[model samples]
Target: MQRRRLGREWCWIVRGGQSGGAATPAPTEKVIGMSFPAADHGWLGAVIKNAEDEAKAEGLKYVITTAADPNKQTNDIEDLISKKVSAIVMLPIESAAMTPVAKKVKEAGIPLIVVDRELESDDFTALVKGDNTGIGTHAGKYLVDKLGGKGKIVEIIGVPSSVTTMRSDGFREAIKDHPDMQVIVSQSGDFQKEKSLNVMQNILQSQPQIDAVYTHDDEMALGVLQAIKEAKRTDIKVVTGAGGHKDVYKLIKDGDPLMQATFTYSPLMVKDAVKLAADIVGGKTPAEKVTMLEATPITKDNIDKFYDPNANY
Candidate 1:
């Protein structure tokens, strides 16, 4: 039998079949539950797509749900638990608020794999996430070197989570050694294009002499670019996260003056978790605790290497 956390107060159970091969009759059509924050923006949209594709490819019966609100996410988990899936893959909307859900899944004896944003629990079976800190550190170092170790910079942070905290901390650590480099303005853009644009506009108005801007996501970076153009500011440079977007690649390929670089944090890692979960259910031993995916720095010189026109997001 397989059991997992459903949300906050429920447990999901999955009946197991005889172990060992594809000859084992496909494990009696086991169901896997996937819960993630709603696709309020580009990064999450890609995450959902990756999860669905991976589930289909692995031939697992799956139920997928999305919740942007923490309470709603808890409710969704309860519903999934009632339905009793074998395993659950979750990308939490709020870390602390999801702990009860993780505990419930553990109590039910289901495998719980937390993805992307982490929850506050050791009860989970495994975790899959990107190196947010590394992404930020790389961006910081690159900007520092490009500006000759000194400049006025602005930062647009993502939603409040451990992921954002690590990224911001990493960036700060990298640039802390450079006395000439300073972050004049830092604000939360909530990882949305409109909010990023508005924040950028406000920063421009307040600090007209800014030299560089670092946004946590590419969609927000695009908004920063638009704000810069609207204000007719020619002195600032912009960098962003998520290098997979077509527009980001175009900016890098064409050597756009405004957009200098981006960090690669793939949404495809969600797919990896699905595959790993399927393997474990099929009696294959997989990593027990966590899987960390590396992030790459995408610059004008090597942007073409990651470009995929056929990619949906």
Candidate 2:
């Protein structure tokens, strides 16, 4: 057995030999590839960090790539294929556009494990992600309770992706019971801080009396906060998702009047996906094709539990 260290974990790889006595040993080198969308935001940065940590612990050679454009991502995958890695872990930029790329990976005979986002085909061997709908629903319920089931709220959404749709749908479902809690204006922020700030500014101008705002991501939340301050609107409360950042935890911990709560959508899911890929190559079968990580709401009462100063995210 040959030993390799991955992050904090140790992995053992068994080598095979010929039937004859004193046969040559199998090679000890093994490599895995990981590809994801560029870290344009805080959550994705966390994902990259966690994946690197896991790769180091498992003692597997790792290759990482990121692309802001779908076409670029497709090309990156092709490059990885040429390298003939043992397996691939991908977080697609666009599910539909990346399906063909997934097929190409499968055709190469490399085990494919997708994280966070999914392609159109089921050809992938495994997937690891959080419940986006659940995160949205939690945010909606929290807003309703804070506003006593009646208030004018606005929503700053992420990019137009399947994950965004699921989060939006769940939020609408949770608030359906509160007829008075209406969403006055909703718009796409493209999941960027500056874009969210500009969109939020326009929304404030159009609707002068918003009681609350729900931005799906913490990066957007920060932009929304700045927009609120610039407008001098103290009436509006905020709820966001992705609780890994230090700023978000601090706001909730101190009971910031504007930022009331956030939902946990850990980037550690990437780490889990990498480990699963290693296991598949090492000959361990997982119990399920899809693994769903829980999404928990982080409120002022329990914010202390997740506040880790040492956390990279």
Candidate 3:
């Protein structure tokens, strides 16, 4: 495999032509191509690692690419199409930005296995991801119960994608019945801990009495916790997060009042996506066009079930 640095992104060329669109490769020369957004947080970092590890473990020829933005990811997918890989597995940076290229992948006759985020159109062969709306619903219900069905909530959202839209929509839907529950401040943390920390700090200064926080990702939740602790704020009773990070589980296990729960959105789902691509290459058709994984809630009551000391994310 040859690794090349293309500006901010990285592209690994295992075996393929340097230019031109996808072509029909011989059976023995077939390669599975993977394109993902660059690791912006621990969860995404684990996703990238799992995808690469799974592709290698399957004993399949593959090309992997990572991009920091939608435009860069678009280029990565185009390059993969040119490589003429047998199948393409992509975890899009943003839904709309990648949908057009996803259509192109389908036009080139390459089986596409979408992971995590969904494209605008159903162009992919298979999609493997955790239940995004379920995560938000679970988180909202938990916070509602914890705060006695009424609270001023602060929401730290992810980027502009289907994941963000669905999660936010589901959370609002869950809290809609309880008119007392209100979102005092909702801002994009962009799913990064440091960015979340900065955003949480500003929110903390602005909002004097926040009853709870509903963060879209666990890393962002951790950042929110840090901000709350630094400011010594006591009004915020609970902080709920999505994406099961081990650090958040530790807090729940230790009975931290603020760090109560997180929804299960494991990065290991990418492993399934890679395996699906390899399966498609091996002349197997997916049983379902979309594979939705469960998003189980993890709290202190069930912390033992998910608290893995050896886990990566």
Candidate 4:
């Protein structure tokens, strides 16, 4: 018997089988539900596409819901819960806003697999994410080496979440040892390109003689680069980005000194999250509760290894 909750009611679904050679048993049908932020950017678009492909490959009935904001995400999760999916995978829009809904999923006895930005509490059965801190730490190290550990840095951040917090913390921690290194100002780009372009424009107006720029996402980094080019400011020597974007790779391959490096934060992490949910439905327990992928630094020296023209973000 399979136990599932259907709209506040707990019921058992009976399975059919036979005694010795009585009849052939029918295959059990199970569905997996997925919820994620809408495809506002390239990385998220790739994540949504990858999840759909993976779910289909697993041969399971699946439904995917995307939300533009935290409130919509909460409603989507609630709807999925009401449907009593065998398992759920969610990439929350904002961690704090979705924490309560995550708890609800737990109370309803649904196996939850959290991807990317994590909830505030451990209300999930499994977590699959990238090494955000490593990206920041490595980016800081790269700047320290390039700039000789002393420079005026401007930081362009993403939305308010654990991802943003950890990356900021790690960068600060990395540059703490260098007394002369200074972060002049930090502003939120909200991980959007156009917004970041406007923000960078305002920043360029105020801060003169800026040495480098650190953007949380590659999309924002592209905007920052455009702003620098439009302003024709040659003082800024280095600009670093997170998340492996093909455009960034092309720039590096073509020897753009300013847009030199990016760290690997692949959107394909959602594939692992979906696979974990499938494993749970297959009656297998995850050996580890949290699986974190590594963050690798990419630069002109090794651009050939990662530069794929046909690759999706």
Candidate 5:
């Protein structure tokens, strides 16, 4: 039986099978309740696609729900519980509201696999994510090296979440050693192209000596690039983005000056989470509770390895 929170709910979670040499029973009771935010961007759409593909591969019945708000997501969790799903795999829309729901899932005894964005506490069965901090650090270091540690850079931040904070923190920490590496304009792009474009445009208007730009997300990078083009700014040499979007990968492969490199953050982490949930249901205890995939710095020299023409992201 699983433990309850607030001394109210009770549920039966996974019970590990025999530890001897006996064969593990293959799980045919494949019902996974996946909940995540609606695809507000193409990158998010890739995440949903990956999750769906993995669930299908395992022959799992999925009650996948997309909620734009926490209230809707909370309701989705209740609906999944009512249906008695074997497990729940969720990428939290936000940390605060989702933490209580994640706690409830734990109390319900349903195996919960948290992916992508994190909840408030480390209460879930598994947490699979990319190294967001490393991403920012790599981008920062790359900019510093390219500019020889003396240049003006602008950063476009993402949404108001742990991701935003960690990425920025990592970049700041890495660039701290170089006193000449100055951040000329810093603003929130909110992880959207239009918003970042507007923000970048405004920054370009105010500043005329930006050497490079670092955007936390590929979508935001697109906006920043557009703003630079519209302004006809030649001073900006390198513009880097995180998130290995197909376009960004292609640009890097072609040695595009503006979209030169990006730290890789794959949406495929969603598939890994779904697969992990199914493995846990099959009496498989994962060796690690928290899995953070390494952030690879993608550059034109090695972009061929990552560039996929047919890939969606």
Candidate 6:
């Protein structure tokens, strides 16, 4: 998942194109670097695809790169700089590991768009993200409300980053008022189905009766369910996950007991980043440099309305 070549395949969509005024043609000489985590998992893969999809729709030139590790990502940044791509949009694997590279990109006068995760400082020209804390709060409150404010829950955490912290903190903050609803333990799921499966297995061994599981991501949520199924644990009544993945939405639609709900945390945020980054690279001024979107809770009550059978994620 290192360096991939560009492929453009859509008519441009610009402000002037759809307006009554003469269409402002898309720039041909500019290139936007679409750098992000590897599409090894569902959400991230959708992120990469949607980012590319936007670029295609806008008729923007792009050099997209994906990395499995932060070190490779750093190297990928240097490569983009050497290629002299006009701007960059990155969703870092971790905040601290990518700060130096982000800072360097900013100092080099390249317009940088930081997406989803965050860094130690504001090292980019713009930022686009979903509300991480709000997602956790939604899930936490759902679990509390479902269990009548009293139950044991296991939290499957995500990769180490500010996103993880915000989600976890928000959940705790939301549910702290309920003293009876206790989170029995929190374990790292690493945002992977396999890793969370193993983690869930280990967690199941120690906990006797868990009423719910709150996974920081839907991928991990899927993992937790697999482990529970394998262990034949009937005590878990609900599982709330973050991220608006299609399969999870289907699970809610199908009336699965454990997969009751998941808050909408879309990967499509990257699409916006790509569009704005292209404009910035072309010397256009955007009205805003920072955009943080909120999360929406998707449950059985509204699953059919939100569930898409053919979405990218």
Q: Which structure among the candidates has the greatest TM-score?
A: 3
TM-score computed on alpha carbons, candidate 2: 0.88
- Candidate 4 wrong stretches, greater than 4 Å: 1-28
Q: What is the C-alpha RMSD of each candidate to the true structure, in Å?
A: 7.5, 7.6, 4.5, 8.8, 9.4, 7.2
lDDT of candidate 3 over 1-313, digit per residue (tens): 4665544434464322233333334556877888877776899889878887787678766677777888877887887787677899999989999999998999999999999999999999999988999998998888889889988999999999999999999999999999999998899999999999999999999888999999999999999999999999999899999899999999999999799889999999999998888888899998888899999999888899899988988
The parts of candidate 1 lying over 4 Å away from their true place are: 1-29
Candidates 1 and 6: which is better by TM-score? 6
Which portions of model 3 show Cα errors greater than 4 Å?
Answer: 1-28
The best-first sequence of candidates by lDDT reads: 3, 4, 6, 5, 2, 1
Please give the ranking of all candidate structures by TM-score, highest first, separated by commas.
Answer: 3, 4, 6, 1, 2, 5
* Angstrom error at residue 75, model 4: 0.4
Which residue pairs show collisions in model 6? Answer: none
lDDT of 6 at 313: 91
Give the range of the ten consecutive residues with the poorest summed lDDT in model 5.
15-24
Worst 10 residues of 1 by lDDT: 15-24
Single out the weakest 10-residue window by summed lDDT for candidate 3.
14-23
lDDT of 4 at 192: 86
TM-score of 4: 0.91
Error of 4 at 202 (Å): 0.6
Instruction: Give candidate 6's error at residue 239 in angstroms.
Output: 0.4
TM-score of each candidate structure, all chains considered together: 0.88, 0.88, 0.92, 0.91, 0.87, 0.90
Candidate 5: residue 79 lDDT (0-100): 65
Tens digit of per-residue lDDT, candidate 1, span 108-221? 877888888888778788889888888889989998888899999999998878788888999999999999999888898888889999998998898969889888888889
